[model samples]
Target: MNSEQRMKSEVEIWKRKMMKKSGMMNRITKKAQDKINGLIPEKAHKVITESIKKMVQATLFGSEYLTKPKETYNLSLEEKEALIKDSLNKFRKTAVVEGAGTGAGGLLLGLADFPLLLSIKMKFLFEVASIHGYDVKAYEERLFILYVFQLAFSSEEHKKNVLETISHWDEVKGELVDVDWQVLQQEYRDYIDFVKMLQLVPGIGAIVGAYANYNLLDQLGETAINAYRIRAFNRNEITEEIPLDSDK
Candidate 1:
């Protein structure tokens, strides 16, 4: 197979893997997360929800960390993937280090990890958007980033819904209303509750934090890349398969 064919195959494999039905473990975890959600105080939940909403809004509209969108139309799939892979690696390392530092600092610092890690994730997404040639300054494009974020951290059922929405974004973007921040915040909290809670523990928090953050970034990176691949494929930018060794 040629390079383009290989790339298409890789993307197909990723899509199938992402769409696969959740297994028994996933269901059990969902149930556990639901119960934990019930135990969290309403006040605490409200605070977190509002905090995340503001933080995300600021990041989406802010120019501080945004990069100039690349003109990848002239770049080959292989070249684009190389840039993406590099960005993902850099973000993964940053997340690991942030997780380790917060995890080692005890409860207060571990608590601090929520916003810190969030910023890292959002900034990484912005970079990914630019690399994929998506103009982040556009309102729809910023909304798309939220959908991608939701896809990465939401439950399996939510993931399926988000994937469908994003897959046909052009059709749905017009009628879309404001994002349901409440639902978004709740789902995110539940999804990470178990792992993050462990990161608050006194003894093993550091190790767990670093490990969890590393894997989280990896998962987000995969989702971002495949999500953009769907768009590229739809636009016919990645339709033709060339020889693996072809310079063109």
Candidate 2:
């Protein structure tokens, strides 16, 4: 296959992976995650929720500290991906350092990691959007970032719903109401609780924090790449023959 065809094939593979049905293990895990969430103190949950809400809002509304959107109209898919990979590497290192520092600092710094890592994640998302040729200054583009965030960190059931929404975003974006931040925050918290809770432990928090943050950024990077690829494919910007199985 030629370069464009190869790119299209890669995107199709990603689409199939994204659409794959959740298995029994996924259901059981969600249940277990929910149970763990229940065991957390109510005050702790409230604190996390409020912190996430504020961080997300600030990022969405154009925090000056975040990366400005780059002009990407002339860049090819390969070029954009190269730039995105570079950004991902930089952010991954930053996360690892932040995690390690906080992890070693005990409970207070562990608590502080929540908002700090969140800011890093959000900043990376905005950069990814710009690299993919989307203007983050637009309100719709910001909402698209939130959808991508949800896709990365939500439960299987919610993932399915978000995938559907993103798949038809061009049609529904205009009619959509504001996102329910409460639900979004809860889903994100539950998804990450197990890994993040481990980051709060005294002895292993540093290792756990670094490892978890690195992997979390990696996961988010993959999700952001594929999400933009889906949009490009749907818009015929990257033309390739659809696989026979795509209609199934």
Per-residue lDDT tens digits for candidate 1, residues 1-248, read 98756767786676566666778988797787678767755754565677678756766677755778988878876688789889889988989999998898887788788888888888888888898788888878878888888888887678878888877777798877657777888778877877876787788999999999999999999898877777776667444532222122
lDDT per residue (tens digit) for residues 1-248 in model 2 = 88767776776776566656668977786677677777766766777888889866875675543455678878887789899999999999999999999988887788788888888888888899888777777878888888999999887668878877787788789987567788889889877888787777799999999999999999899988877877777776444444424335
Which candidate's lDDT is highest? 2
TM for every model, in the order presented, reads: 0.86, 0.87
Report, for every candidate in turn, its global Cα lDDT versus the true structure.
0.79, 0.80
Ten consecutive residues with minimal summed lDDT in candidate 1?
239-248
**Number of the top-ranking candidate, with TM-score as the measure:** 2
Clashing residue pairs in candidate 2 (N, C-alpha, C atoms within 3 angstroms) = none
| Weakest ten-residue segment in model 2 by summed lDDT | 238-247
Count backbone overlaps in model 1: 2
- Candidate 1 differs from the real structure by a C-alpha RMSD in angstroms, to one decimal, of 5.5
Off by over 4 Å in 1: 31-47, 237-248
